[model samples]
Target: MFQSTAPQRRSIPHGRRRAALWAAVVPLLVAAPIALTGEAQAATPGTSVSYATTCTPGVVPAIHGTTISEITVDNATPKVGDTVNVTYDVTQPASGNPTSTALPANVILPTGVVSLGGAQTGTVTVSGTRTNPPVPGNAPFPAFQMTGSFVVSNPGAITLSPGNYNINSNYIISLDTPCTIDTPPAGVSNTITASPATVPNNRVITDSPSSGPAGTKVAISGSGFTAGATVTVAGFSGTTATSDVTQATADASGNLTATLTVNAAATTGIIAFEGATYTPATASPPVAYSVTAVVPPGGSSQTLNSSVKGGTLSMTQAGSTVTMTPVDFGTGGSSTGALNAITVKDFRGGSSGWSLTASNTNFTGPGGSSLPAAGLSWTPSCTTTAGSPSTCAAGSAGAVGTAGATLASAPAATLTGGQFAAGANLSLTVPAFTAPGSYSSTLTLTLA
Candidate 1:
């Protein structure tokens, strides 16, 4: 050791000097965190901070590094009066963590401001729980996710900044953690663009019955109106409208129903009706109704007559019932008989004449025994009492089978209308083994 100093110098105490140095730096350190949060008052819209500090115990609390919180909105473009949701997440740092674990950590967030056009009006209230996992004694603080909501009152670019929050330790005590946002880095913030409010379309439900006479009561109904508001009903003729001034209140479901009387002096034309309100300045869609002029008192009866003219080619029979002369076969042989005269009057007025056909069902007798309709044969004779250019010809001789035969027919160029009479000579053959009994069959005559 070289002891070359001529005078001995007094040394200052290391503990006192260190204490003085710490006293100066400690105040600056405390004030630095506060200044960062206080910048929120003069912060630009949409700017947020990345660091935060806990003020729990109102005294010494852990100050965390950056990567503190992130805010997100459910709707970025919300219309006026629309409710929007916000989420604030408290992220854990990479290294720092508490030594002890607090079970069931419930985060209670604070209320923030909604800034629009540089003027803050609406408030956002955040709340919810975010618990930590059951780790051992040494464990990092768990992340927290808090939620909140606010209604968009005005339209424009809007900004949101999260406020201070607290942790409810074990559901027993509250711990304040003020994580106020400061001047933000570029493009890091919670921002949204609000759109103008939209209006609903007017709905006019019904006006019953398409047409009605004047002074008639018409039921009108509509929907989509202010609740418990009076509506004015009116009738519009062309561009001019006459108000019925019928007062009707809207129900809880925003539906309105009212009765409107057509004007007594209304003309016979199409008219429109509407239900309207003034407070919100809304009107329902126009419902069209046809209004008929009122008829005079004694004008009910009007003499009317119609000329009855024959339309289609048709025929009518004179008699209701007829009986053919019966022929008996003594020992089961063929017998011939004359058929009753069939008189038909054709009142058809067209040159296209018609043909008359005849058919017969099987003759069923006692004990369900039957004879085939083909067992009978006929020779038809027809005559028409019509004018010239109209002629009726008798059908060809053939067996009267179930399929029927043409009894009489007039050609297309024949008479337009006439009285026609037909007669047939029928011959029936019976087998020797046939039972002896009387049988009847239905003979159908069709004119087409």
Candidate 2:
């Protein structure tokens, strides 16, 4: 470095300095545009911090000539297990070229509903022409159309809200069968009636019997009697007698008959006939009949005679004497005398055993004269000294006596008459009887 004494430099003014700096920086600033262009070319458009924006109409633009119309789903009534066809039509919008747009893929169905196969989702083409014509040259927008169907397994009315929903939405479509829980027809009733109106008394009618005989043929005639009708007979004591009777279907006349046989030994009582109609109709009233048994030969009559007068005889034997007495036995006593008795003949005369003797017994007057105490005796045989022959002897002579007698040390004997209402119990007691077997005698109780 040469050290030289420079003349005192005059200070440069600020404005002149600034002008000189600008003159030098002018070319650099001028080259900035070229550098920015190069950098811009190296980077992608998206990386830029600044961008431009514009607004477009929210609604789809209208197409000329082609029109857009709102779509509607009509309410439908469907039967169970039946399919219903639903149709929706779209009209293209005017003022803009119609473009092909696919319909939404899914539609919500009501609860308890299922869609039939096929026709689900996608675009369908609808051709249309521009009225005013597109602004020269550009291709006309394509139009779209679509169709679908569904079925209702249950019957009902379903409403759809105006909005998008997932599958199986708010309400469901259903079909109901006739007569089911939901669907029912109007005006139906049931009734039942008997045929012939009245059954004959004492006649063996098929179902109605007054007194059924063992082989009696009865005809039970009634209305509402059909092939499946059941018939039964009930007795007065609630005893039920069943029979597999013949059943006839009603013709145009609405009458039927069933034949039945009455059982033998059935009590004489009321006969009741009952019938039941199934499923389709109600049952009928039970018919009844009064019955009686046929009379047999020699059977006692139910009537009584006013003029008959009854009398009775009682007898007892003591030691060697037999006594008889007369008394009133009433109506029952007279009936007892009517019974027949079998006599046992004695091959060996026995005077000691027992006896009914005519000579020993005596009758008083009128009513007593008819008493049967004669020509009967029970005697024992006596041994002869030679033992060659045996002799039989009557042990007692007769005397009038009371109906009962007793021995000093004999077991008590009881004689009881058959059961009788009122009056007296016909009884006898005998004393000193020497028989181990039963000894009985028949006496005539007179009905004067």
Candidate 3:
């Protein structure tokens, strides 16, 4: 019912709060969309409206309002059917009044809402509890202020849950004057828009190998965390290796991975905490872990190597050079030139047998011109192509020893190793008619 004392508006009979506000003396039976009207024409400028604790001065009059404010349920995202407190009001002193003032205000809401006060305005619906403006002058109410909420009612096919709501609190204040009633504005209302609501997702933590031995490396991972956020991974030990922590950062994808090394002394019943931040407001689910004193079969790995030492053999020539003194048949009978002692080393690991051979065995002149094989002999007795013995033959019956062996294509003698040094005595018995015009030969020794 309309009263002369105050112009009160009610929630659309059975509807949801939308972005628009609607008001009518009688319930609007039609569900047609309400044509939006602009801001109310300036109220004479002689009267101003201010919601601040202290009104701003030195300015023209204007109407500023909050068209859309959030309404949540138990701190969660706002859903249809949720209870909420919605407040709104207009402030203007009622000191000067010609006859009376009639300013109609209404709350329009979306279509799908249920529960909470909702009424049928010509079109839209809305929901929210408001702090209504106190009666104009008397009842201890905020001057020219108003507030209230509407119930989201579902009448028939109308849904009070989710939709683009046209919730507006519109008003047109009229002042009656004896001379002439002041011409007021067309429409004054709060217009606002809001993004759709959604539910919050839960966070999660996981690991590669859930259980392992102390000192084993494990990969810790997390998901569904805030983007570009920092989280700490803590290791809580039941006994021995006690407390430890590390931090990881989430990428734009809201995921992160960190590696943790189990303490060698860590015991069972270990836990890891992936905190939202250094000092988090919310505690994520704790990640449980286990550590064993003995490393599991494949937990740790060891590498071994097998090696062997090689053998080396070496031979050193007395001086790496051999020089022969001139031997002349002019004073022929016997001429012996002493050569450097050749040394052989048995280094085949542990004393092995070896042999040595000399090339050209016999001293020869420039072009294949040779010397008598019998004429040259060595101090050691060995076999050769020439007569095995010369003038120094085995004379004694039981003694099998000759003075020396002859040097043919090869030395009538061979050298034995296992000895450091063995002397090479060259004996040359020159024949009386032997022609000699400075004879020289190259002797090469190969050892193995």
Q: Which candidate number would show the highest TM-score if scored against the true structure?
A: 1
Expressed as tens digits, the lDDT of each residue in 224-299 for candidate 2 is 3334434333322212333322333444544456554545453222222224321112223233333345567888
- Ordered by lDDT, highest first, the candidates read 1, 3, 2
Q: What is the lDDT, from 0 to 100, of the residue 138 in candidate 3?
A: 17
Local distance difference test values of all predictions, in order: 0.50, 0.23, 0.32
Off by over 4 Å in 2: 1-209, 227-239, 242-254, 267-283, 300-448
What's each prediction's clash count?
A: 1, 44, 55
Give candidates' CA RMSD values in order: 44.2, 60.1, 52.4
TM-scores for all candidates: the values are: 0.32, 0.19, 0.26
Better of 2 and 3 by TM-score: 3
lDDT of 1 by residue, 58-81 (tens): 434555444456676655656778
How do the residues 3-49 of candidate 3 rate in per-residue lDDT, one tens digit apiece? 01112111211111111211101111111111111000000011122
The alpha-carbon deviation from the true structure for residue 95 of candidate 1, after best TM-score superposition, in angstroms, is: 10
Which 10 consecutive positions of candidate 3 have the poorest summed lDDT? 35-44
| lDDT (Cα, 0-100) at 423 in candidate 2 | 12
Question: Sorted on TM-score, highest at the top, how do the candidates line up?
Answer: 1, 3, 2
* Poorest 10 consecutive residues by lDDT, candidate 1: 31-40
Model 3 C-alpha lDDT versus the unseen true structure: 0.32
Candidate 3: Cα lDDT at 165: 20
